[model samples]
Target: MSGEQLNEVRKVIWLTGASSGIGRSLALGLAAEGHQVIASARSDVELAVLETLSSNITALPCDITDASGLSFLRARLSHLSSHLDQIILCAGNCEYLDFPEPDWDMVTRVMEVNYFGAVNCVKTALPLLRQSAAERPHIVAVASMVTDAPFPRAEAYGASKAAMRYFFDCLRLDLRSEHIDVSVVNPGFVDTPLTQKNNFPMPFLLSAEDASRRIIENLESRPKNYSFPKRLLCLLAVSKILPALWQKIVLNGADGKARQDVLNEKVGE
Candidate 1:
């Protein structure tokens, strides 16, 4: 369907991670476009701020890791007038593997938030999404472009996003007969509170608002995958297609030393 046609049909959207960053921008943007947007996040204050920004938005604060909390969120959704037309699973956490021994605990923590948190939201939102009368019920996940290539310190974060991408892709196949569309958003370095902690340079870094606008524009097509900005995506693609060259040129000993410095700084902090 065309973008205009899709926009004409105002959707009831459930957006997680709505406290800040891309999620916050998306909540406001969708509300401005006349969609009923249900915003979820652990920060009640932030969600409240989002609600004040737009009349079309409803604040629903709950931690994705808490199963009982999710049940409460589900109950709250039941009170809405219409079923969810789309679910954007944007709740995620990122953690890098530092020096010494590989921190399996850190890996699990990242997975818990990025992978399992999204799964928990999906468990609650799928029923509501199924209730939509629209030709296609959409599921949009915020995975990372880092998953396209292995980065030195991103062992946990990259793997979790990669797992999410795989899970959503498999889900798309399963939901095809039901006309449920799953779109995985692979964002490059977006300038959010999360990425602000990074000590290294971030090429093609986009503001949260720009990221949200791109995501909203692309979701109209409901493509299987959405990646940006073009420059970063192309860089990662090249790295994947030619690993040996990337290892020698893109990631040399200097890169390893820089990552070590980051780890040391984190430890000191």
Candidate 2:
């Protein structure tokens, strides 16, 4: 659909992970645009604050990983509004694997929140989206651009997002027959609570508000896949083309030492 057409419709959108970061900013942005937003997150306190900020937003606090809770959420959604026109599934988690006996359980933990959680949300939202009075209902999943290029210690985070991305891609095809549009959003480094913990550098880092604005604006076009920060995209593309060199450059430490060299330094100390 054209931007003009997108502007014409005020949608009922359920935005998950509305407690903080991109989800929080995006919820406000969407609400500001006059959309009836059912804001969701695991934190009741945060959701309450979000609701107080704008009448356009309603707080629905629930853990996305809880299947029983999602059913209850569907009931709450029905009570709040007749149908859902769109759903922006932004709920995710990240955990880096520490090498030299990495925490294998972290893989399950990350996948549970990022991948399986998304799958559960889609199942819960599909019925509501089908009831949409709008001509076409949309599903947008907020994935990470880490899938474009591998990063050290990001085994769990990147793998989970990559799985989510592929799931959405397949869903896009299957849902086409039903006319439910699916969009996978892959964002580069953004200033969020999750990223603040990283000890390494994050190039092209954008504020959550800026990222939200870009996401909300681009969703107007309903592109199947949206990835941004063009410089990072180009870099990842280069990585894809020349993997060995990419690894050499990226795995090199902040002080121009290779990862092995850094490890050796630590051992010597």
Local distance difference test scores for all models: 0.84, 0.87
Q: How far is candidate 1 from the true structure (C-alpha RMSD, Å)?
A: 6.5
Which stretches of candidate 2 lie above 4 Å from their native place? 1-9, 254-269
- Among these predictions, the greatest lDDT belongs to 2
**In candidate 1, what are the lDDT values of residues 1-269, reduced to their tens digit?**
12233334479888999998888888988989998888999899999888888877888788898866777778787776347899999988988888777787999899988999999989999888888878999999999999888787888999999999999999999999989999999999999989998876576679999999999999999999999987777666656787875565445456645544433343343
Q: In candidate 2, residue 104 scores what lDDT?
A: 99
Model 1 whole-model lDDT (C-alpha atoms): 0.84
Error of 2 at 253 (Å): 2.0
Report lDDT (Cα) of residue 199, candidate 1. Answer: 71
* 10 residues in a row with least lDDT, candidate 2: 260-269
Against the true structure, candidate 2 has what lDDT? Answer: 0.87
